[model samples]
Target: KLTAVLTYHVVAGKVMAADVRAGKVKTVQGSELTIATAGGVMVDKSKVTKTDIVADNGVIHVIDTVLMPK
Candidate 1:
């Protein structure tokens, strides 16, 4: 449960808003997240409401919905 949830929320590499293109990002938990940038960036089924929030270790993207593992 924990692993799924965490992996669902995380994607490998630091992705910036400008650098974000339509693709799949591999998660640490061994799943790939679908990323789309047609109108806006989406992580899985969740829409990214916010982006590029600088953190000490990495950047943060705020999603409108919680990501669940498949």
Candidate 2:
């Protein structure tokens, strides 16, 4: 049900934590996500574990936890 939201958090291109901090990115769901440094390079509550998984049409980055929208 919420998979769309989670997946949308990912960028279409390979975005490392370093790259993410440079700007605000749009999600697949048309929402905008603010990337910044918290306790660490945090995306909501999840820390990006793996990055730059290339697919035929997109990319995937693994996070340590799930993100719930408020």
Candidate 3:
């Protein structure tokens, strides 16, 4: 359950802030996450607080809430 929730927050590949688009993206947990780029970038119901945190494996985008896989 915890693992599923964690992986649900991640999308495959290194997606930067500039590359983000308004659509559904497949996560590593085998679930699709809805992304909105209206006023700002939103992941599901969570607003993206931060973006483009470079990591060894991939990039990270901080969200306001934890995403749950349905």
For TM-score, the strongest prediction is 3
For TM-score, candidate 1 versus 2, the one ahead is 1
Regions of model 1 farther than 4 Å from truth: none
Task: Report lDDT (CA) for all predictions.
Answer: 0.83, 0.64, 0.90
Clashes of each: 0, 0, 0
Model 3: per-residue lDDT, tens digit, 1-70? 9999888887778899999999999989998988999999888899999989898999988889877789
Please write out the lDDT profile of model 2 over residues 1-51, one tens digit for every residue.
577766567556665445657346777666666665656566655676787
Error of 1 at 16 (Å): 1.2
| Order of the predicted models by lDDT, top scorer first | 3, 1, 2
Model 1: per-residue Cα lDDT over 5-30, one tens digit each = 87678776787787888988887777
Candidate 2, after superposition: displacement of residue 53 in Å? 0.8
Query: How good is model 3 by TM-score?
Result: 0.95
Q: Indicate the residue-level lDDT of 67 in model 1.
A: 78
